[model samples]
Target: MKMKKLKYLSCCFAFGSLLLSPVFAQNPPESQADPQAQSSSSENSHPHGKAYRHKMAREMHEKMQRLMDKQDEELKKLANEMNKAPKDQKLDKVVTLLNTLVNQRIQMHEEMKAMHHKMMGNHKEHHE
Candidate 1:
């Protein structure tokens, strides 16, 4: 059972890293010496100004951090409960917690996908 749990966690971590790699891999906008060039590049890349994008990015980062912290706390609590649970109840509790975590991850992924779609739509509109 412990081995199964460890394998499950390992798979989750690998999948999550794969999903988030692109977001982390993005390069920051380069500094352009020419103001006009910089402005044009910014406009072309993102309809919203650089400051607005920065603010949005910061807010999103904070939100993600908060969610992660909450998840961590919940996991810790669940772990404590599982530790104290009777052997007969441990399996059920473990299954429940696994379901909860998987559901949360799925929800988060869906929300991110929707947000990406919305952003892409806006980008298309701006370009058109």
Candidate 2:
């Protein structure tokens, strides 16, 4: 009976230690995570002021709209110039207008991309 009781206690002790092993284990190294992923996680854990973010987004939209409207006006001016050109020069004028329009469009696209990048960077910073 004594031997049986001692064996039972030792078995219980082993099982209890097994159950609690995780509680004593070292935490996984944070360096294992991608730096950007860790940074984004930390940023997400902290929230920006809702009103401030909204206001910034609204301003950005307004600025983009203004830029688009200016582009439209420039395109219309190009169209007028092409229309007014002499018949002999019409093809050349059209080519010039098209090139100008393409360049303007490319510039606009680059500006918009830059704006988007800036906004996202600001948003991440503000979140923290």
Candidate 3:
């Protein structure tokens, strides 16, 4: 009786795998890849229409750059404030600010990884 039950469970599991395998084989889960290909494909496919190539686009790009510069300036100011955040301040608040700073750095690392991949591809294309 135990052998029959074990065999039934094994068959059921095998049947479930067979059903799921087709769906995954057609479209893989994102984890199975590093996702660089998907990002590259999607970026390329975005139309450089009027919105992307027009004067407004240029202005938008410039504005974004300016905003990034402003953010850097603000972060610098925050660093100065952090430097002066002394023993008198609540430790939890100081710790929270420091954690936020570290989190920003982690976000920057992800951006850098993507940028590095993009740059390397460009370099390879240029050489070719």
- For each candidate, what TM-score against the reference? 0.59, 0.58, 0.35
Q: What local distance difference test score does each model get?
A: 0.63, 0.65, 0.51
Q: Candidate 1 — which pairs collide?
A: none
- Candidate 2 vs candidate 3, lDDT winner: 2
Q: Which is the leading candidate under TM-score?
A: 1
Q: Pairs clashing in candidate 3?
A: none
Q: Candidate 2: minimum summed lDDT over ten consecutive residues — where?
A: 19-28
> Candidate 2: deviation at residue 37, Å?
19
Comparing 1 and 2 on lDDT, the stronger one: 2
lDDT of candidate 1 over 47-72, digit per residue (tens): 46566646765776687788778876
Superposed Cα deviation of residue 2, candidate 2 (Å): 99
Q: Candidate 2: lDDT over CA atoms? A: 0.65
User: Residue by residue across 21-63, what tens digits does model 3's lDDT show?
Assistant: 5321434357535544534544555564223334543664575
What is candidate 2's lDDT per residue for 20-93, written digit by digit as tens?
A: 45521544368733434545554545565455656877988898789878977976887788679876565566
Model 2 bad stretches (over 4 Å): 1-48
Question: Higher-lDDT candidate among 1 and 3?
Answer: 1
